[model samples]
Target: MSDTKDSDSDSGTGRCAGCMESTSEKFRGFLNFLWNPEEKTVLGRGGKSWGRILIFYLFYYAFLAALFAVSITIVLGTLDPNEPRFQTRLQAPGLSIQPKLDASIKRTSDVIFTAGQADTYTQYTNTLTEFLKPYKENQATLNNCTNGKVKINQQYSMEKPPPSCRFDLADLGPCRNEPYGYDVGRPCIFVKVNRIIKWYPVGFTDLSKAVGNADSNAPPLKDVLMARNRAYDPNRMYVSCYDVTSGNQTYLNTAAGVSANTMYYPEDNGIPFKYFPYYGAFLQKDYMTPLVAVQFNKVTRNVDVRVRCKAYALNIQDNERMRIGYFTFTLRVNE
Candidate 1:
């Protein structure tokens, strides 16, 4: 019985050794296939087959890259780098104001704050201070255009850039003071006409001839300036602001008496004609948009008043809905 058990154990050991040898041989063959196969084939693919696939992909990607390059070149060829291709909507420029409202405030266009509180109006004064920094720094070097001569139909180039007029900060008068009159219940708001490339303001020589009659709803330019008692200047682009909350009566004769409370720096309330026909930024690198500072003195306390400011010129349109050449904002002074 012991001899029979020994023979069976020997047979089992030999069968296990044979299975281990077969597995080792199969693993060696798989490694050889991955590194280098027989019959000049690499992983079952001949050299010519690999070469054909590589060449096909190279040509396909090369053609795709060439097509992309040509498409971009053609598109860019049709555009002017310095000027806009289409300016149909920008025929007339718009208006903007300084001392913009705080970003946290929900009402963007309205200026509302308590008169005596520093925290309430400090942001407004800071904005104006930063805005005038460049003008204050560069005023000495800028070209003098105080002769009131317009630069029109002139050629400009990169080598010979167009000259920009100097807008002296000193001309702002009392509004140029550090406090800007905000601490005393009065506020100064600066109005700027947006810059349009190669656009100039054309003033009316005669209001009766331009509008075809003096009885139009649009008040004559002279009447609009009558409140301020400014003499009419046909060569200048005039800016006028008045209370819109007054009923039926024209802006000059508003019930709230806006003209009585308003005063303009450089008293004329007009932008000189020389500032117009602004060439592009590249040609007129130092160009500064002229500003009209409107100071509101002794506004009725704690009342929400709507004001509309308009820039009058023969070329500039006055469409309230479109906000072309005009801007409206609310003013509320708290006690």
Candidate 2:
């Protein structure tokens, strides 16, 4: 009985080995379906089936790509390269004052000055230099703009527009001095008017008519023409810088410690007439907004004073709630 049981156990073990060998061969055959050129099968599908799937996916992606391209073409067709689609989006252009907020300050409109803090002031001065690089001065193109006026008559002309008026960095004068006046707690404020295409100054629309009449009663027109005549008229635009803490005055606020003095340099209170009717970047690649530097001669040290600079122009629209056509910033000097 024991010898019969031993023979039966050997036969059972042989059968199990045969079954394992058969399973291995089946797995190998299954793998061959993934890449079997001889059988014309790929990934368990015949050549015809695989070709159909490839064709289907190719057409599917091709249709998606074609739809995407058409959508982009239709969207781009609605836009005008020269004119802004939303003309009424902002009724008035904005005034940008710089030495913009330092990286540490999250608020975009405020400037903090610490007397004797070279790093803080250095960052601002460096930004000013970088911003003014395009307007540094180009003697070669100076002749293109005669007496600081570059005329642009039409839009989309194949020929390039006239060169922009030269706004040399030297025009900054004392504001360009070393340290930029922050060391002494008197920081320089640069003011630039936001560019609006085809928006002319509303206040001076009748400037030519006003210029023709020499009547003293027309003080507004006389002032406009006089401003146009002066090499650099300081009164073209009435700009006022005021200390917010002083008081809530009218539309214009005069800077504290500045009532008896003028803080504007080079006479032009702010943006000059030369940079008007902004031609798009393509027409004038080197065009830069004219910058006016306002120096605070009597800013109190270690005090926080809110400064607001307003540019009064007939064409410059103002918002009751927003600082439209003007800029407001906080000035704090620490000892």
Best of the candidates, lDDT: 1
lDDT of residue 315 for candidate 2: 58
Output the number of the TM-score-best candidate. Answer: 1
lDDT of candidate model 2 versus the reference: 0.62
Tens-digit lDDT string for candidate 1 (1-335): 99999999999999999999999989988777765645677776688988999999999999999999999999999986657788888888778887886677543767778888989888888888988888888789898776675778887788878788999777788898767988887888889999888788887877653331221234356665777777777778877766666533233233433354577876788899888778877777788889999888856667777766777888887655556877778877787
The clash numbers for all candidates, in the given order, read 0, 5
For each candidate, give its TM-score against the true structure: 0.77, 0.67
What lDDT is reached at residue 270 by model 2? 46
lDDT of 1: 0.76
**What's the distance in Å from true for residue 74, model 2?**
5.0
Cα lDDT of model 2 by residue, 1-335, tens digit: 99999999999999999999999999988889677878777787897897899999999999999999999999899997766788776677777887775567453656676877897677777777766655655534543343433334655543756456666666677886667788876778788777777654434444333221111111233443243353324325545555556553211123323342325655555455556667666566666766777777666666667676666566554554555755667877777
